[model samples]
Target: NDWHTAIIPNWLKTIYAEDPFFQKTATVYTIHNLAYQGIFGWRILEIAGIDEYGFLYPEIAELANVVDLMARGILFADVITTVSERYAQEILTPEYGEKLDPILRDRKDRLFGILNGIDTEELNPATDPYLAANFDVSSLDRRVENKLDLQRKANMPPNPDVPLLGMISRLTDQKGFDLVGQVIDPLLRLFDVQFVLLGTGDPHYHAMFRRVAEEYPDKTGIFLTFNAELAQKIYGGSDMFLMPSRFEPCGLGQMIAMRYGSVPVVRETGGLADTVKDFDPRTGEGNGFTFKQYDPWAFFGAIIRAVETWKHRDVWRKLQIRGMTQDFSWDRSARKYIEVYFKALEFRAAETVGGSRP
Candidate 1:
């Protein structure tokens, strides 16, 4: 149950209390994002047909004069989960909790974070129709054709030697466009890298990226619109993907890029930290490049390392293979959800037997 639909879960729970068959059933409420809790005026409580059930506790339903739907869901539901394990923990802090930290802290034991996975079949690079070339992990050499095609399509110089960097994200501060905006021009001036960005959000970023593309037409390719086909092409064609998010709940772009053999150069925050690892040249064990600091130089440093590693064909290929072989599919995550269900059931059973008072 999310805030927008929190009433549905509460209504179901009310009905469950009456029916003996479902009396002991546990209600699970999932918090996809805690920032957008549906806190409305007290009138909503009456509209939701729950005014009769007065919220006596301030923590349960009331946040000042408003009725916090998210709070009610958290209070009534037997279990709560966030999108990623790190994000679940992050929301318990004052910085990320959006004024709900105390309420979440109370239910820390019941809260869970099961990392979200992708539909591997739908995102497969081997069978994608939008790419100029179709290739699998073993046939990575054919990926160059796609790179060349993307170069031509973007009207950039068709130089396969120069590393191509791809970004498919919303142009927002949280997505780390602020850091990119700061260092992109300087990085372009120095490096022999070609950049292609596809996204649309925040008018200022649209103007900013478009200006950059105009200034460096030969090396920079920017499309200030969301195109799914172009996004797939970028995933397939690019040598490296970029996601320097300030804080990401859980990212699917990095996983998609890996599936297409594009190594991600990302900031170590939230799921980005959990997924992408720093590549060690000596060991050649990690999948992609990662940096801990949110600073622009840190992001640029990761990019530089990726480009340097790209110079060594054997090492670069190994990195791509490692990323591609990663199991980012839903099977593992689904099992974790099963475990959550059982844990919730166990908690409900214990509470029922003990006659625990809320």
Candidate 2:
């Protein structure tokens, strides 16, 4: 779905260009993340046996002497898509394009965006064996047992009144760890909240979070290793799920957390923006808490709002129920993909009849 399989489009357009069966074959390239483009030295083109075609876009100076497989996939594929609609639009700009904006803009007409969906059957909280207690929207009161269980496992005090925030992500600046590092100390000191973090990443973040754990032993839980069971526990147990990504292609974590009855607190960017609507207290609508700017104070402000909202027990329960009931299944995303596939075939048909690339 990303850089690894990106070269297939190049090979199909080059090696199989004249093959009768391949001539009618249309390729659809899906970009899960744009940051990790499969870039290599120009000599790699000879190894790929597409040296005759050389660099596809020599006019773009940055790609003129390099073999960028992702670019080739975008350029040669009949259709291109990203994991989320917002990311597809974001990648067309220089900020999130990873130096591929020119090429992506060139193929913008053929590009589409379809959000990735979680398997609802597998992620169902009601059927999850990993959770300490199983509950759905109808029986959300039963969800508190999971929070107590998670607290005991993390060696923290089991207080149902304290708001527990859970995070399962790669500890990196891109995931908004920089923002977390900036505001976590004040957040812990000023608020009556608890934080539980899972997943492993950069050594810098590991040391930083370790300091947090040591400083706020009573309120913080840090698990530096990945455990699928623990991940589910965090999802089902935590009062709020944190995903402050600077840019997310299509984050499944927020969706899964909501499915598990954990209200999401996310940064408004990419898929996070598409899926998480800012909660309006006046209207009593929307799914989660969101902040737009990629600033520490902005993130801290959102967390404060979530904590304040938690004070009103009835309001909090309604928020959790609202998040839990939303449909994030693959059915909707599957239909969009089917539309993109048909669009790819139409492009292929047009190319064949017109004897020109679409």
Indicate the residue-level lDDT of 237 in model 2. 97
What do the candidate models score in CA lDDT, each in turn? 0.86, 0.89
RMSD of each: 1.9, 1.4
Best candidate according to lDDT: 2
Off by over 4 Å in 2: 53-56, 59-64
Candidate 1 structure quality by residue, lDDT tens digits, 1-358: 5798776556645544556676578767888878778978878877887654444556663644677788778776788888888888888898888788888899899899888899999999899999998999889999999999999879999989999999999999999999999889988999889999999899999999989988999998898888989999999999999999988888999999999999999987777877888998887778999998889998889899999999999889998999889999999999999999998888878877786633
lDDT of 2: 0.89
**Clash pairs, model 1 backbone:** none
Q: Please provide the root mean square deviation of candidate 2 (C-alpha atoms, Å).
A: 1.4
Residue 307, model 2, lDDT: 90
Global fold similarity of model 2 (TM-score): 0.97
